[model samples]
Target: MAPLIVNEIISPDTNLLIAFLIGIGFGFVLEGSGFSSSRKLAGMFYGYDTTVLKVFFTAAITAMVGMLFFSLFGWIDLDFVYINPTYITSAIVGGVVMGVGFIMGGFCPGTAFCAISIGKLDALAFIGGLTLGIVFFTEGYPLFEEMYKANYLGTPTMNELLDIPRGVFALGLILMAFAMFWVGEWAEKKFPREEY
Candidate 1:
């Protein structure tokens, strides 16, 4: 039932169509959640609002739990799932770069697109810069190839890396998420902001 396209249950075209629909739905949800507002998103950094953090944490935990249960129920084959190969240096560099971008622009790439759908001028500018960045990265790939490929770690899930059972890892993450939610609530109360 899972990986319908790969399993040949759904045609490639249908897979792409589904992806497009999902993208539209995702953008709609983002906009509805006030994610299109840079002020709201930036509030997470200022400790005045933690909606972004909570939303992302919830999403991560939900997916982790969903996959674990799906595997247990044999609804999906965990082995068929793709895990990205880790390059330590590049991962650190990429994370730092993205973090800086999020801080400065107050929007991640996906949210930028979501904002653009609502005709946000700032989002347009962000997307312009993002496009330029992409072009620069593509053109400069050769010069950055060595660093990008450095410290290769074969794809491994957190449970695998920690030598723990997946269920145990999922439980630990769930608890962590709950704690973060509490912290987020405290931050919002401690640093109140005017409505955006």
Candidate 2:
């Protein structure tokens, strides 16, 4: 009858090894989930298929609920978990850029890597573009540094920022996801297309 100690259980090297193993599993799942196919991924935007939405939302909810449950039961110390700081302006700008990239490239970072590993030519091109983009960013970091650091909103969770309980936000997200799923289901029927 002992509680689970999930934080920093091993040395950094061991943690990295675990990360590698987890990454392998993640890559396997992505490939198996048809994320390696640009056409399938692109179908999300065109309303042809919503596998991406389903998978992404399912994963998010699962992680959210699991974390909540774990913290409730004191199995994991929630304080040790890293939450991203809310940089409102930069977050919005970066997300918009990434959204455009997703639509244009048909591959986010993880999926692009998985596709590249599977010998996808388009994914390879995307990777090249990503590398060039990173290089450009680094080279022009000086010029963009000010804008990047302009919005200095320290790490504030939704609960902190909105003065609402975390559970309320989680519940809201779940409801919104359900609504989107309903729409996706309708769209799938309304515009059935041959799958790639």
Best by lDDT: 1
Clashes of 1: 0
- What's the count of clashing pairs in each model shown? 0, 0
lDDT of 2: 0.85
Best by TM-score: 1
Per-residue accuracy of model 2 over 11-89 as CA lDDT, tens digit each:
6677777779989999999999999998888889988899899899988988888888988987777777776776677
Runs in model 1 lying further than 4 Å from the true structure: none
Clashing pairs in 2: none
Give per-model CA RMSD: 1.4, 3.0
Query: Cα lDDT for residue 19, model 2?
Result: 77
**Candidate models: Cα lDDT each:** 0.89, 0.85
